[model samples]
Target: MSFGLEVMVRSALSHIGDLIAVSLGISLSLNNLLTFYADRPRAILAAHKKFMLARVAELSLLAAFALLYQQYDSLYINTIIDTAAAQFDAGVPLHWQAQVAACLIALAALIKCAQLPFHGWLIQVVESPTPVSSLLHAGVINLGGYLLLLFTPVVAQSSIAIWLLLLVAGLSTLASALIMTTRISVKVRLAWSTCAQMGLMLLEFALGLYELVLLHLLAHSFYKAYSFLNSGNAVNDAIRLRLSSAAKTSFQQAQTSNTVVPNAQTWLMAFSISLAVVIAIRSLFGFDGAFSAWWLFALALTVLIVQWRTCEHSPSIIYTIIMGGFLCVIYAALKQAMHYVLPSYSTLTVQAFSLADIWAMILFSLLFVLSAFLHYQVRWRAVRRLSIALFAGLYLDEWLTRLVLKFWPVTLPARTKQQHHAKSTHQPSLKP
Candidate 1:
């Protein structure tokens, strides 16, 4: 917040941009060099050498950053804010400790721009299949979010930071969506969309209230992950490209039509339902304030499912049982992890083996066994049913269990028995 420090921080941020630009330049230069000399059979030796050198460049930078943080005790580059965060706020002499935050912010920004070692072989990626490109450059990568999250304290405090993130997310989204229209390659469009979505999430984290940020991130990540995993769009595009390439005499280009009706009713219904759900959830949860609701998550999931193009039909009873069993596996993993990390939470036992805990455990142990038996549980109907059930459970935890229990306490059979015994003994004494 101090004048000089702010200037220095901005300088550091600019440095990050500069680093990204430099990395981009180097990457493109390597591309051209590879194109010209990389193709020669004899260049295979040189290719290996160049690859090794690029790897070295990446590793060296990473190590230097690590060493700088380690040897310099005054340098505080740790994730958790130390004096540097404060000093970064103060214009104090770049205490060896404080300069690191700026450096880290810079580092994270640059690392984000490059998309890192995964896409290090620039020529190879530029020549990759569409699906691969989408997954690599656009869809699957999550480092940007991680980086932003890592430095949220620094970034979130400033309006410019929020605006920058919004610009990135918004512009990327628009560019990708627009480009998708012109792109013959579906996967490429998907990649662009992913980048845009990621930017949106980063923007939301920067601009929105802090509470909404993580949930937004969670939802966006999963939705994007789902789309990236089963992207038939790219495959479809590949087929179209192949068809176009095939002999013209043997086949005719398929006629396209704009007859597909824009389903306004469905969109309206979905939006209404989603909004209703958020309001209902908040109300049911008995949120501290009235009318405070958020449904970014549900919408994201719904979008992903809709895009996956699924249909529903009744699942066999056996299949449902099998799916329940899968939930058991998930529950088991969750419990094990929770137990390992949070031993004190075991106090969450539901009142000395009440129907709640008993049923929960039985359900946990049984559901997955059943699901395993009914392992062919791929139908959307089954998935929908399971999802609805899960949502019901979440509602119970978030709303009913908390709010309802506070007002209406449960009466255990043991308590009832004890009361009866006490009354019986008093009656005998009174008669005497």
Candidate 2:
């Protein structure tokens, strides 16, 4: 696994890197299946089944690349990028072959990144050892986004391929992010978070924001690794947080006759402040795509405002404003650093406005509004139903699981009396 990853990092622009990376992914999947087969045979088998499906898609991607090599007489990624970029600059559409290859690549990436129906494997793998789960989420799962970034030039030239990634990743991002909140287990929540983060990263790639993708990849890796390694402390942390929240709630009830919910004007003020802060930071950094960046900033700021409103004794407004500005500055600086370090094609400037960008902005706004509604309107009947559906992942994974098991059944070992007793006594229950 180590050797495969090393080769992947060192030779990412070559065919060998792609081969080794996919091989490593297969090896890891098999490793997870085998390592815990004795303890959780059913889950391991299901995970392996999904991995095999992903393998087929990845093999198709490789075959597509081979066809591209035949047409272009080159397998080097840099050469393909140059060819695609030149064609794009000259207003020539990508060859049909390149378009097919890009589409196949997108399909493989979506499956590998655990989007939607394929995400059950990622959640199941939490049954493995903590270290294994950490490595998988932090290091291996991100290879899908890496694959997309490596072929950015080709993907950029194919509008069909780009939109395929955009639509799938966008839905997965929104669904997974919302679903994660409905989970109770720390590791399960983290697994869903990885799904969401991967979706968002792929969405950024589809939007031609390669620099942002790189930064996101690195930051998520570290964060996930740390979260997994420290997950043992999560129970204690949750207890402390609940206690503090209870105390805060009691104090707020005592101090105020009514809850001080933020009105439309307060939301407007927060949005305006967030927009100004983002614009100022982007302007200072000489960044493009200010409008897209502002949407993200506004979403974050509004979430912050909602949290503060719930707390009632959170930081003062001036401190909140200062922290918001500081965060924007930090984000801009990191993005600028990414632009400086990445390759020219990966850092190519995007248009100020496009259909995809506009759609993504609208999606962000919708998510922001949804989050606020869910947090504030918990008593609403529709919200309760929506929360239940989200918690169940809308049964998307269940249909896939049933289909896989029906076609490719696995034999289970006979259950011992002790195992049966334990199962009867402590059957697992879902938590909201």
Candidate 3:
């Protein structure tokens, strides 16, 4: 793991560094397969197949890169970035080779990040040890984002590649988020959350929010690591929370109320306050293209307000306003900090809204509305049906599981005599 990170650090100097990093990442994943071999033979085999597929995609990306650059010297990171930026500035469309390279890069990263149909292995691997799961989620899964960040210049210029990424990652994000809500096990929920988070990270890349992507990457790494490590206490924490007065009240209210959706007036107030806070912070920090951030902040604050109202424990208006403003301020500050640290060329600067921008705005707005609807309208018949489908992950993974097993079938390891004896010893007597 340390070696993979070190190689990534060198990725800025040479494109070869990314290849090496990806190789080391696959090696790490293969090593984890060893740990899963005995108890989860099927999972190990499936994960191996996925990892090999990713390796193949990475190799294809390397070939595409060579074809696009046409020389070893021009393959250096700075040269590629300069060439891409020059083309972009000149309003020159990307050549077909460059477009292919960009698409290959996105494909490789998506597989590595475990997006959608490629995500079954991520869930299956949870049978492994907790630390292994932590390392996989917190470190290995993020390599995809790093890959995209390294080639941001090439990707930003390829409209086809961007749209491809947007469609896949956007669906993955929404599906995984809703699926997470249906899972009961803590680790399973976290795994689904990781998938959703990775999807969102890739979506950010597709939208050319490189700085925000970096910030999201760092924050998610720390949070996932800690969450996985501390998951043992999750049940106890849930019990305590449920025993609390506020929680009990909220639960009862949710159970008894026929209509849980907040009034339009409440939503309007929340939006107004959140917008005001974001605008204030934006003016202070001089940040641009923060529409997505504003939507997220509003959603979070609205959820909080709705919860408080449901419990009949609404906080003072001033205090709520202050907390909402504080949250927005923190987000803006982190974004600005990332912008200042990264090189100017690494982050794409948007001077005006494009068609892609408008589409992205619509997507985020839909996601916001969908999230609110799913949360508050669980009692609705249509929502209940949708929730059931989501709980089964829309049967997405089942197809992949069947396909992988059919073509490259793996047998479960035979049990040893000692294991068989233990099972017999634990069995109830036939006489009873």
Best by lDDT: 2
Give the TM-score of each candidate.
0.39, 0.87, 0.85
Please identify model 2 stretches exceeding 4 Å from their true place. Answer: 1-13, 16-30, 33-37, 239-260, 346-350, 423-432
User: What C-alpha lDDT, on a 0 to 100 scale, does residue 292 get in candidate 1?
Assistant: 14
Q: Deviation in angstroms for 275 in model 3?
A: 2.6
Pairwise lDDT winner, candidates 1 and 2? 2
lDDT (0 to 1) per candidate: 0.39, 0.75, 0.74
User: How would you order the candidates by lDDT, starting with the best?
Assistant: 2, 3, 1
Alpha-carbon shift of residue 350 in model 1 (angstroms): 36
Alpha carbon deviation, residue 254, candidate 3 (Å):
8.0
lDDT over C-alpha atoms for residue 111 of model 2: 85
| Candidate 1 lDDT for residue 176 | 33
| Candidate 3 per-residue C-alpha lDDT over 89-123 given as tens digits, one digit per residue, 9 for 90 to 100 | 78777777788888888887888889997898788
Off by over 4 Å in 3: 1-18, 21-25, 28-34, 71-75, 90-92, 238-261, 345-347, 350-353, 415-432
Q: Give, for candidate 3, the lowest lDDT window spanning 10 residues.
A: 1-10
**Ten contiguous residues minimizing lDDT sum, candidate 2:** 1-10
* Residue range 1-432, candidate 1, lDDT tens digits: 233323423444334334344544554455344434333432333233334434444443454345445534423333232343454456434443224433444334433433212122322333333344434443224545644543444444344445454444444433333333333444444544554455445544543333333444455566655665566666776577667746342345334322222244643444454445544544554332111113333343233323322223534535533443443344333323322221121111123234322332343234323332232332457654654453232232234223433654433223244446768787432110
Candidate 2, residue 301: CA error in Å?
1.7
What are the per-residue Cα lDDT tens digits for candidate 2 across 1-432? 124333543565466356647655665566654456454665566566665666666686777687678757887766666677777777777778888988888888898789987888788777777887888889878878887876777776778888898899888988898888789999999999999999889888877777788899999999999999999898888678667978678767768864556777777777777787877777788766525545777679767765664574777778778988988888877887776656655333455567888877877777777777677777789989989999888889888877877977766456656667767889642210
